[model samples]
Target: MLRWLTRSLHRKLTFVLVIATMVPVILLGMVSYHTASTITEEKAKLTGVNTLRQVNAIIETMVLDVENMSVFLIGQQEVQSYLTRERSGASEYLRMIGFLTNLAFSKPYISDIRIIPFNGNAELTNTTILQSTLFQQVDTDPQFWKNNTKWWSPPLTTVTSSGIKQTVSLVRPIRDMNTFKTIGMLSIGIDTAVIAQRLRDAAVDGAVMLVQDAQGRTIAASSTSITPSFVKIVTDKMTNSHETERLNSVGEGEDNQVVITAPVPIVPWDAYLAIPHHTFSAQNRYVLQLTAIAVVLAVVIMACAVGYFVRQVTKPLIRLARHLPAVSLERAYRPLPVESEDEIGTLISSYNLLNENIRQLTEQVKQNEAAKIEADLQALQAQIQPHFLYNTLSSVQWMAWMSSNDQIANMVGALGDFLRFSLNRGMQMCTVQQELEHIRNYLYIQSIRYPDRFTVETYFPDELMGNQMLKLLLQPLVENSIIHGLLKTKADQRGLLTIEAETPEPGWIRLRVCDNGVGMTEMELHALRERLAHYRFDDKAALHAPVGQDTSGCSAQMKPLGGYGLYNVQKRLLLHYGERAQLHVDSKQGAGTVITLYLMSNWTESQLNAS
Candidate 1:
């Protein structure tokens, strides 16, 4: 049974059960203990306060009795007449003495009684001697009698003739009734042991009690179990006027103990109550036993619940895990069937939808790839056929002008070089140096065709000669400018064309082509920008026109040439270089047209060689 309990699901569920059950149990125990402790402390404090109040009431009554007797004695007609007469009748003096003696013996706490005459000459009378002998003091110093009139005087030690030690004295003044002059004084002594006995009888068990004067000196202590250290703590705390209850560690070594200290009400000292830690532990032992039994029962219940829960949760997760390996990248997988309308069922539904979408997307992607390949092939054929025919015609013309036709021979040579460079041997990219050579070849052909009508200027940094570019890009732009802006004009004046290259910043190159010819109107320019912006490349054939056809003399209402080659060039540049390879066109009507191409500078050697 022990082994089964240890190895069962209870072991795994112990943490949950312990946290759930023990947390509240421990919290409730702590709160109960704290609240009980607080109530116990408050009750102890109240008991101490009540005891102190009782003691204070007893002391106040005793003091008031002493005061009343003193007042009564001072008011006695015999004593007053005696003070005025400078000597009292012996019988009346004996009567006053008898009254005081009766007053002293009436209270058990009072130990002595006497009277002293305050003679202006400071002479010791027979009565003063009697009182001094009773008090066991050498003399009642006149200064002690003179300075104190109302405040209680400091305690004096008194030893009786029988050799018993006692604390002597509560004293007050006696004044002449008519003149209100200080004539003498009355005194009384209280037995400190009697006060201690009263406190001991009234105090609760485990209580420390003390009585003190205004200076915080101990007048009496009720329990001998209280150490000097405890007395010092009470005295120091009382002296500092600290009244709050506090837990104090007392004694040293094996005698160490904790106690709660609370101030006594209307008294000059405090009371302390102490209980050992073992006492609290002993009281809580049954609580601990109940907690252990509850924890054991809780563990049993939680184990069964957790076992059911974990089995239910882990089974689906394990099933999902088994299906994970069947999910292939090349082919989509069907999900496991939903067993119920729970978390696992929702997961299964999501998985199935994800797989279905992935499979459909995969089939659509394959179709799109096939169609793209076919379209690329068609585009390539379209590009290749025109160059093939153009090259063939140039070859035929070159053969036709071999020797006798010098001008035609030159034209054929320029055209052959232009065609060879435009085809670029079917290469897609070429170096800036090679592209410049290709442009030079095209310009040579254009110059041959219109010898005195145009002048071409080329400017390039030696540093940009090695940069790579898309093949035939610059040539087309240059051809477009010459054909559309320069060739259509009938002016005998020279058309100036400029080709320039520069690097304005790191990792960037700009190549510009400027021509002094008829520029487009704002409306035509706007139309051109709108077409190029859309990346439409279906109008290439419409842009191409015969070399000598003139549009300069045509009516202003005639539309300009339309084409997709320029649009295609801009789109391909943007695709490769993003926004950085922008094509900027600036033109002024009849002044000039400038086309600029911006591109990154870090083209590879192989790309440059191809270009």
Candidate 2:
């Protein structure tokens, strides 16, 4: 499942869509639930405080009514006559008890009433005998009866003539109306059940309400199963606090409950509300459940929608992927069908065009290969004719020598040597010495053909002898100078041919072929340089291009080169050595023409072969 989730685009898209939709929804749900929970808790605390306050009011009113009854009985004529007489018959005592009972009945929360005389004697009562232990403490402690202020007794469980009751009483000292002398005590027993019932009526759901006395004893509790720890927590909070009402918490986990307490003004008691924390979060719980449902629904819908859309996109890509192998193998591939007029459709069209271009490029490459072979064969055929001519000339030279014709033999010998070096077994490169030797042979034949008409001078260093250069480089240039320049001069004005070679700087060799003969004008020099600029050795046809017909006006036996010799030298130099090889012509009418060839000096044999 993990691998599929990682590898499948469809699965990944679905997962992302689900996450994208659900994350913010879940986050918002949590925030909203927390916010609602906080508000609900605050409202619950306020409600509990208000309810406790109301409980305080009800219990205070009930206690005040009981205390008011004591004041009313103290002023009663029947009770004053009886106390003054200091002795009462059974009828009078019974009558006083009946009046007290009737008064107790008048106040619903009062269970019993009693009148105690200080003379170690009990007077009429509501059928409950006051225990001597309770009075002994009051008698021994004069402070208990010293004041006329009302007081509340501590919580206790005792048997009354009516029933076993858990209660506390409001106690007041009855004094003489004129003398202000203490006579007896007036006591009214208030049942804790009345206060507990009032607390219960004011409580919220899951809330435990209690009425506890000033001494931290529980008068009554709304919940029968109240924990001791919870009671202690409330007691400690009420003990340490000065506020009338506030919110608090007790215990941990399930035992944890929120407590709110308020003082009861009519008595030394406190009204407490302790609600379990989870109970107050009922509304927030409903919100969280609803929010969870909403998030699930949203994620489900988004996942379905995103999955369908992603399938639409990835299906086309998958089909396109199936064609990749054919492109890799360089095989003919069918074009993808255009499904829409979108970027994908445009992509398919571009791919089809690229495939077409590849086909044309392949055909062009094949044609180029075939043309290369044809040029090689033509070059071989070209070499064969020169070979045959050299053999025929050598035979002619032998015959001339046998016939004792020295001039004919010498001229034919030079011709044979020239042709042998020119062919050079179809090699485009030859040593500088070999090339100079070939040029010397050509000059020898030319000197014989036009003796005394031109004089040849040669100067070169031994260092340059070992340098390799393109074959036939110097021959054509010297030939052009003799036939076109030296021969143009008259016999009385004899021409001079100078061939010089030198190293101008490190890594560079320079050669010059100069003729002190009829030179060309500036216009002709410009036209010739322009013609050389257009020259290319690879295209043999460019050599045959007319560079002005030769006008040397020498003997008709002089061969017609069509003025290609000088241009051929320029083309070969530029082609073999690139631009680094410089060819320049210095000339002026009635002066002389100097042709310079600049080449690198340190090129190796392998480098020359590669060139």
Candidate 3:
């Protein structure tokens, strides 16, 4: 489904445009929302913390007032003697009620007070009904009777004619003023409405207010709207740090809560205000809605633009395609009219330009074909004359033989064989044996010309002579030795040139041409080697096409740009065989020069036999 939606230029472009419009809007909204949310959260935390602290102070002050009142009542000489009395009359009991009533009514936070005596005397109370159930439950309640070191007791639940309610008490054992002995207990019930009202007043929106004892037990929570799981989480997070924390506490299900714990004075109870995380994000709702609206509007705008663009692009091509069936390609191109200066117009102009170039090329191809046919006929006529030269050479040899001149007959035969091998059907590579044979014929002619000027020797093994290599590779080296080395020797010196072939390794061959002629000096050898190194890079080192061939019954030599010497040999070896083929020229001034060519042997037995 996703691939199908993004398959076309229109849909993809729509997505791109919408995203381009929406990214900065969304980013700015997010950054603004985050900054505002942070500031608001801190403010909420401060307000919550301050409210909890004030509520804690109120509870602490109420506890202190109750404790001091209880002490003052117990320490009164008349009340102490009355509480310890073994027999108390109606006047004393009624008078004791007045003392307890005045102490209870002294503080506004004290709702109800009681004095239960161990001695056989009637209990004093402020209410006329004198609820006996409260007395019985307070006497029997397990949690209510727990030992406490603080001046005030932890919050305890009690049942009255009203519904269940929570309250703190200053429940202390009253001591006799004379002996410092404990009497019956005096419990001052703190006003439950006052504490509850305080909790409600401090309650921030979406905050679950709680009152906990010093033992970290939940005494009363102001909110029943909270889930039982969240209440459990708040109670479980007993942070020692006085500051509020985003306590990600308890067992994992919705455990995150912001718990602000403030220590209540005197009693050491803690007042906790737990605000849920959802409440903190209430401020970002407006920003998020605005961003979403902007994205939707951008998407709508993008849809209109992309649809219009795609229609404009595809309409022209559709119109052009409709005309294609009627269009025809003729010898001369007739241009289609350009309707508008858009890409479609350029496309029509390109089509007309291509058709014109194609028409011209068609005419050129026809002319080339005609010229090729005429040249083929001329080539056929020329083919008849090649054998004429061979026939003439054969006739000359026969004439020399008829006249009994064996030297002329032998020379003519050698010349004919040499010319035949040199133009061996235009094959660039020849066998080692055939190449050495060509060299032998050339040396015979040279020996006749300068009989005592030079001497030539050859060493070729039958095993290595059948290997195939580049044709005429050795001829240039031999020619260079004769022309530049051997022919330039001292008059007293008879130049001796040696030609040899060897196999240094399997599948590799080396051909050597050494001459005992006037060798080059150090500087001359350096200059020649530098020229050979840069032969391929030198523009003048390029081998030129021959202008014409000399067909006077002699072997034709092709003069390359750098002359057909060691430079030609180096260039040919590199061009044909790459770096593996090597040409090394070793020479000592006035002593000798050795030119060795190393190339791979690349022919099978059939190829050698064919050569």
What RMSD, rounded to one decimal, does every model reach? 23.4, 30.9, 22.8
Model 2 agreement with the true structure over 1-611: per-residue lDDT tens digits: 89979876767877887677778877877887787788888878877788888878888898778877888888777776666666677888888888887877777778778787765444768767635234433443457566437777777765766777777877777777777777777778888888777777777888889987767778888877877777886656444343467677777778788888888885677778888888768735676677678867876777778878888878766665566546632465467787878877787778777767777787788799999999999999887787588778889988999999999999888878877886687677777789888988888888887878988889989988987677777877888788778888887888889999998997788889999888999998886776666654445454344444332222334333654466556655665676678888889998989999888865665776566
Per-residue lDDT of 164-184 in model 3, one digit per residue for the tens?
Answer: 555666666676776756667
Model 1: CA > 4 A from native: 1-24, 81-94, 118-148, 161-165, 179-181, 225-227, 239-611
Better of 1 and 2 by lDDT: 2
- Collision pairs in model 1: 118-184, 429-610, 429-611, 430-611, 431-611
Task: Show model 2 residue runs off by greater than 4 Å.
Answer: 119-122, 129-139, 238-243, 283-290, 311-611
Model 3, residue 202: displacement in angstroms?
A: 1.5
Local distance difference test values of all predictions, in order: 0.64, 0.75, 0.71
RMSD of 2: 30.9
- By TM-score, the best candidate is 2
Model 2 scores a C-alpha lDDT of 0.75
Instruction: Predict model 3's lDDT versus the native.
Output: 0.71
For every model in order, what is the number of clashing pairs?
5, 0, 0
lDDT of 1 by residue, 494-547 (tens): 788899999989888888989888988898777667655544224332223332
C-alpha RMSD of candidate 3: 22.8
- At residue 61, give the lDDT of candidate 3: 78
- Candidate 3 displacement at residue 21 in angstroms: 3.7
All candidates in order of TM-score, best leading: 2, 3, 1
In candidate 1 the C-alpha lDDT for residue 264 amounts to 47
Arrange candidates by lDDT, descending: 2, 3, 1
